[model samples]
Target: MTQPFLSIRKLRKAFGAFTAVHDVTLDIPRGEFLTFLGPSGSGKSTTLYAIAGFQDPSSGNVLLEGKSLLAVPSHKRNIGMVFQRYTLFPHLSVAENVAFPLRVRRRPEAEVKRKVADMLGLVRLESFAERLPGALSGGQQQRVALARALAYDPPILLMDEPLSALDKKLREEIQAEIRRIHRETGVTILYVTHDQEEALHLSDRIALFRDGRIEQTGTGEDLYLRPATDFVAGFIGNSNFLAAEHLETKDGASTIRLADGSLISGINANGAFSSGQKTRLMIRPEAFRLERGPTSAELAVEIVDVAFYGERRRIVARTAAGQEIDIRPTSAAMASQEATPRHRRVFFDPGAAFLFPA
Candidate 1:
């Protein structure tokens, strides 16, 4: 197997008495897009800074290509960084901004010009090379920032919420541009973001952080579908969590009783959950279906609210137990069930439900 390009071994950081990052470790493969996802103050940014050598770790080692970077200076690390703000020099033209790093490296003027032109073309902003930073749009300025980061031909790039300053449409546009540049250049990236959708869309793998610790790390689908912990299940996406009591296991399948006295049979227990153990059944909003099958568990609910989301309809239902459940149905499925009144019976398949020990 090939070794990872970046290896973080038991990395830790603390501010005075408060530990910002606690024994975090991860391996980022070469040319892979890895994202650190979490809420504010979750240590995601701190970890990124530590890896970039901007913030010293309280303990542990950061290795790049099997070499420890403990004594390396920030500027000498040769890692490229793009922050939330464009950080472009307002006084310099786009071409000069992209050439800043090459100049710092004392490259010959001829070579710097060639590299700056290539970088601008890579970002599809070759035409804007002569324009000053103030003359370009926010998105264009960010492209310049990206071009500048790549000017020196760094092996790894670190982005800290780089797209958060743009509007929604512009953010998406830049996201695609970033992906394109990553593929074309084959540069490994360590991206940091709090947006779940962005992380899911951009990362090859995601490290979900919480309270200065890594809660879980997996592919987007793994974290979304087979979450290892309840925190991950709730944090990754929308879920309907129903309380249940574990029952007997038969033939590797475990049975659980719901709050409404409904029996739900699902895969085996995740941990050492035994009979009578408290559990929570997790089901996505779109997992439930409205059907008339007799074998399916029925719910007595009232449609309290409805929202049309182009491709699907979002329905908020209040169960007889007074718990609110969110359900999403395709436009066709919703049309087929239009005959049902506001207060109606809804049924869902047990196979779609995932039970997790609470």
Candidate 2:
């Protein structure tokens, strides 16, 4: 078997009496884009820092292409990094900033000049080569930072919420540029962010952290559609988790009794559930339909609000048990007359719903 391009073995980090990262074991193939996603203090950034050698792990090993990196100094590790804030020198021109890494290694002047030009062009900032860091917008400064990180042609690049400082529009614009640069450079990237949509958009795979350990890791679709736990379902996307009791399970499908005394069978169960065990049903908002199908179940709800949202209709409704749930259906599925404050029956396929322990 070919060894993984990058392997993290039982990586852990602690600060005094607190453990920031638990034993995290992950393997990444060369040139893969992986994101560490979680909320604040969840250890996503801490794990990235360990890889970047910002701090030594209390225990465990970090191996790149089979060699251990623990003893290597941060500057000697030969890894590139971009951070939440642009760390460019205010007195340096964009070209000088890009060339700094090369100059540090005492590369010939001609080589530094050529590499600087290539890096600037790669980030589409050739026109701004002479511009000072203070004159550039937040987004452009970030692009310059990206250029600097790649200027040395490192095998691995670590990004710690590099786009968090930009406005929404500029953030999205840079996301596209990052994707294009990744394609063109084929650099192995490990990014850290708490934004689920950003992770889903940019990553080939995501490792979601909770507390001090990884909750789940896979493609965005895997976590959204086949979540291993209730936390995974709630974090990856919007979901309506209704209270229920597990009645029984047969052939991997379970029957559940909802809070309002309604029975729903054929739900995709996360694990074998015993009869009479309390549980919750997770159904995505988009899964709810206005019309019922042969295999779908119905829920009686009182419409609290409805509004047109371009191609989809946003609905806020309350269940018979007084639980408010969100529902969004395509405009084509909802007629103008049906968009009103009244009692309605929402339909959803049992196969699309997941049952988890309460």
Candidate 3:
């Protein structure tokens, strides 16, 4: 097996008495896009800063291809970093900004020229090369930053919420550009962001950070469909957790009775559950079926509100116990069913629901 190109082992950080990161470890293979996703002040950025040499880790090691990067200065670490704010020199033109790294290294002038042109072209900013940073748009400025970061052809690239400052449309445009660059260059990338949609859309794998620690690390689907903890389920995607009472377990699945006294069996569970234990059932909004199907569990809910989305319809419902549940059924299904469900039975496969202790 090919060894990881970058390995983070037992990384930690602290400020005064407050610990910002705790024993965070991750292995990133060459050319893979890994994202550190979490809420604000959740230690994702702290971990990235450690890898970029912006801060010395309080403990543990950061290795690149078996070599430790500790004690190396940020500039000498040979890592590329694009920050939350575009740190471009306002006076420099796009091409010059892209060439800054090569110029710093004192490469031959001709080689530097060629690299600058290549970097601009890689970011699709060839036409904007002569424009100064002050004249460019937010997206364009960030593209220049990306070009500058990659001008050195570093083995790995680090992005710290590079698109956070842009508007929604511009953020998506740059996200597409970033994905294209990753595919074309195949440089390993470690990105940090609080945007769950961005992580799901861009990363090959994501390390979800909570307070001072990693909650889970896996593909978007892994974290979404089979979360290891309630935090993972709640963080990765939209999940509805309804209070339930555990009934029994058989084989790998367990049974639970919901707050409305509806019984659901064959539900997936993270750990063992005992009879009469208070628990919660996690069901994704998209998992509900408008019409009952095979091996389905039913819930009695009163439709509180409905809204149409492009692909699915958003339904706000209240259970018999007054617990709110969000359900998303495809538009076609909603159109075919009753126009307005005053109070109805919604069905979902028990296999798709997860049980966690309350």
TM-score of each: 0.94, 0.97, 0.97
In candidate 3, stretches whose alpha carbon ends up further than 4 angstroms from where it belongs are: none
Error of 2 at 202 (Å): 0.5
lDDT of each: 0.87, 0.93, 0.92
| Predicted candidate 2 versus true structure: per-residue lDDT over 239-337, tens digit per residue | 999999999899989998988889999999998788899888999999999887999998989999888899988899999999999999998888854
lDDT of 1 by residue, 239-290 (tens): 9887789887676567888777867675445565688999887777887678
lDDT of 2: 0.93
Query: How many residue pairs clash in model 3?
Result: 0
| Model 1 score (lDDT) | 0.87
Q: Give the winner by lDDT.
A: 2
**By the lDDT metric, which is better: model 2 or model 3?**
2
Q: Which stretches of candidate 2 lie over 4 Å from their true place?
A: 336-341
Q: What is the lDDT of residue 43 in candidate 3?
A: 97
